[model samples]
Target: MGQVPDLPIRNFEVAGQGPAPPVILVRSMHNLLNDAAQRALRYLDELDARSVAPSAEAVAGLSRFQEPLPETSMEPRDVLALLDQIGSPATVATAGSRFFGFVTGGVLPATLAANWLAAAWDQNASMVVLSPVGAALEDVVLAWLRQLFHLPAGSGGALVTGGTMANFTGIAAARHALLNGVGWDVEAQGLFGAPPITVIVGEEVHVSMLKALGLAGLGRERVVRVPADSQGRMRADKLPKLAGPTLICTQAGNVNSGAFDPVGEICARAHEAGAWVHVDGAFGLWAAAARERKHLVEGVELADSWATDCHKWLNVPHDSGIALVRDEQHLVGAIRSTAAYLVHGEQREPHHHTPEASRRARGIEVWAALRSLGRSGLEDMIERTCRHASRFAQGLRAAGYEILNNVVLNQVLVSFGDDETTRRVIAAIQQDGTCWCGGTVWHGRAVMRISVSSWATRDEDVDRSLAAMIRCARSLGVVKNNS
Candidate 1:
């Protein structure tokens, strides 16, 4: 009773008068996007005018996630202020012409705009009825992607979270088919006390594959590790004679040097042994679409299932990956679920092809990205990235750095002087912020891993990065000491 006497109530007559209608929300979003686009264009103009790299603190801060918010709405101006408070790192610049960091992509206008629309619509792409336009876009995008990779007709495609999930879906399908061949209903019974299935993979396989194995109930350490060449390509001739239900995991592109395994031979050996072949092509699979690099993935079409990322080579924004299976039944059998209450009817459902129930409209961005670039434009992007990688390797080699691995696709691995020098150069390069590259232990030596993949990158950017690398190497006393 102590201070509750002044509580006032609104009249029922004023209850129906709302501040704004739902249509205003839509209009507000449209206006916000238009304003953002105009601002971004102006910022881009300014960024392109500058030659020096921005401060590391400034660039790296962009990745910081904002604080958790209360379950409430704020004023639009307040939200904009929050966005301005956050700073992003140079990774977005890695998508720009000047950055040569990990494989990253600039936001293509069409993809960016489509993603905005997708969020606005907030469509769940689990089934056609959930969002007919999203479902249809996925269908068209999958068809075009299949054709681009030269995959055979009738192959099933799924838009997943990213390459890891893509690999998971592809391997799941492979597991289903391989285990089913031996009379094991994995999906029904789970991996508890099931017949052990053999999984053979190249030593150079990406870490995501191992993660996928764990997720699929196939033990990572249990898989047979095949030997790889100096360039990290799997030795197809060394395929161990195998019996029983088995799965052969091959690489379409080595994550280190972008080298591809002997897909034809590997597929033939797996087929001969009655094993399922799954290719983890996260970025390399798209090389087949580029005429110049198509030979790198010569035998990719023979793969039983494959995984690739739109955010990587395809240059779509984050969180877009595709999994393709040669057999539709295998994909459906692997991921489909049943529930009496939520009957999906006798129609093709998106959930059956993916390991998701209520998923986002990821295909909209992919469709927009592909349609914006078209086939030729995409091939050009791949070819140009490869060329830039070669340029980087050549430039580094000329500057006295030990170029490791063959400049096969778009990955270039190099070392300066000995292990210590290489480590120092990598640290200096990162701290210097002229460009950003990653480090990896390759062939017992720590080396710099440079991946060229942005659509915005050009010859000048490659040259500038190479020059910066040379300067760092020289300053570390490595070039003269080695000479």
Candidate 2:
């Protein structure tokens, strides 16, 4: 095909007559930073007193950002002022004590402060040469995480954006190891004409797992589907007959019911049949860190690879996930990139272990999270949130409502009568704005999910949210007189 005709370039817009920003680095930087910090502290300080959800007027004020790009740069302090004034009002208080819409945690004070400091450092984190501290912190934290999760001493991992990328990274390594066993260099030759690898998953597998499989060029629908039990756990007995180049994907935590698959049983059976088992633990993986909750993930250590989110139960911050593999070489083999100009030092390059090269120093915040919490503090956070979930279930059941799940972890699924009534009650609760909890469909019926994943969520916050939920249900006729 011939090329299309060329078009004329548009003329540049006229520049505004305004003062240019300062070119020199000066002590005034601290003034701008102090102003921004004060604004952020004020916003956070008001979270408990204000409504959890933004008001309609606050959301509508987002239109202030719709104007055309400025021809001249505004002062940094002025820009920060506009952001705090207009942007802060429209944000959902996920960082507060009452946001239960998802299985994600509020940032710990240490991690949040580390994030701010790391942003100022502006480390690329691609290689040890570029950011030695960043790479060193990754090595140290990966070790700490391995011990925390009770993984094998030899296991290693890399940080990613979230659970989806974590799953993709682990699954990609599994693909590489499994396909390479039969003399197929899948990475070098591509999947074309490669050996067919059998993939298996349960009925209640999260969509993120399917997305990860699809991203790895493994057909999402091509895998065999196993049946799950009433609690949304994969029945190990129902696993299909395993044969040649097989990969079995298991869930450590069910998104809705908070039920964990029989990972130990499945691993034993899969290993006997010469198949690889991978766990998509996401948030539930953190249960291993709590002494009382470790039994829930008994066989989790036996998996070939695992994916989890530090942002969820670990209470670090948003967009922090990890992909750990028993053999570090497998992960490096799947994701490592090489270039003549790139620096290859004696130290392990952070980029070699994950799917990105040019990323922020995420490991810094994670290091701060672990260092500040230590072992006991983390365990306390996990156990405390789980107890809060049980409290929610108890309060709702006492009000003549149904508690669908067993309340095993930090998740609770409550059904306020029929599907229509459940949906209506959920809407009214959102409007009430006392707390934020999202709705989900569980096993076939509509239900609301209360995920107490944040370190900020206290016993009193749970009590307040429970009261609001019951009141909302009573308003919608789902409950009579809240009795």
Candidate 3:
């Protein structure tokens, strides 16, 4: 690193009276973008070949970016150069096929391209007047998602940051609708003196759903926790007597076991009691696309509200979530606001349906991904990921490991032996880094959680990852070297 360089002064005038059109930025921007794209392409090209986790040296190299703020602005090209050289290597290859530490969906090619293009456009999606394309894409993707998820025919939704926010938005709508039914407008009058709303959740309800409940002013601990069966499905028989203004939160997929709750049963029970039902599908809601997995979440469309993440199962770039409500008015009533400067047109304003006032048009990448991968392509992707998960379970179980969960969907939990040995095996597998899997406590046992979540994953990738896992376990004396 050397002395920071000062940027040259740039001035631009009105359209007819400018001294000269600024060409320096145009030239520099072209060069910088080209450089960035090339570097990105190279990173993606080498993604699978490298370790899923970054090397220690690369992590140590991040110290280079910790310098004090510069007194003078550096050239854009120099800034990008420093970032690309230093930042790229330290990233975990979640975009690659083998990284499975979380429910991370690898960005598809079309979605990646759309993300870059959307960034360049830099449109605020708060209002349709700001970006017609953004609002239009949001409208399109919402319908496509509702249909694909088997949601209500005319349900409305918002494209938010991710699953947490998606859950927040959906739960907010449930609060509004339920409170309104009891002649108390929670959104308008606040929850201070409102009717007490009864909230119910499954025993294995996702943390995000609880966070959403708290955010919506429904006390997380105040909810009735329904008991769950062995596979983490909410026991429909265990649901408390539904009474008063109630909101029942069901799970589409259990985070640990990937099992689904009896959503249809809960929906029936709640509807009979005039209670609103919400589902936190997160990644499992995508199972609707495949007939094989669809049976797991049968009658999902009957729910009053649903929330999911595009970044998890749709293979889109991160931080995209979809929140859908069967009744459009409830979603709009709960999330919309009026401001003099906010000129909302006839078209659906993206912000009104979400929590944020200003947000990037996430629907652009979602639209691009769905358009590129049509009905058959999406179905194939989900089915393929489940098949890969089954393969992992088979390989690990065949090698004398105890699988903690039923191989139902794209999530598998395996134990190497006892808790200590399982922990050691997990640590060793991560250190070996042929592929990446996370650890979780399932059924009071420590187990390695493997989530097959990317379209890039194939038979060969699963085989290679399985081999690495068994090799690491064997090296740790957790598995016999019989294979």
All predictions: root-mean-square deviation over Cα?
Answer: 5.9, 7.8, 3.3
For each candidate, what TM-score against the reference? Answer: 0.90, 0.94, 0.96
Question: How good is model 3 by TM-score?
Answer: 0.96
By summed lDDT, the worst window of 10 consecutive residues in model 2 runs over 1-10
lDDT for each residue of candidate 1 in 1-483, tens digit (9 for 90 to 100): 121222112223436795544554555555555656665565566555443355666666766554576686665544554565453223235446665555666667788788877887999999888888888898899999999999998899999988899999999998899889889999999989888888999988889999999999898788899999998888988888988888888888888888899998888888888888999999999898899999888988998999999988887778889999999899999998878765475656898898988999989989998898899989999999899999998888877777888897889999886788888998888666567787888999999999988887879888878878888888877773332
Q: List the residue pairs that clash in candidate 3.
A: none
State the displacement of the C-alpha of residue 440, model 1, in Å, after optimal TM-score superposition: 1.0
Candidate 3 lDDT over 1-483, as tens digits, reads 232233343565568897556665555566667777888999999997898888899999999999998888876777878988888889999999998777889999999999999999998988898889999999899889888887777898899999999999999999889999989888879999998999999989899988888888897799899989999999999998988999989888888889999888888889999999999999999999898888988978899999999999999998899999999899999999988988967777777788898899999999999999998999999999999999999998889888888989999999998999999999888888789999989878999999989989989999999999999999988754376
Q: Which stretches of candidate 2 lie over 4 Å from their true place?
A: 1-24, 480-483
- Residue ranges of candidate 1 with Cα displaced over 4 Å: 1-13, 16-31, 42-73, 89-92, 341-347, 480-483
Better of 1 and 2 by lDDT: 2
The predicted structure with the larger TM-score, 1 or 3, is: 3
lDDT of 2: 0.89
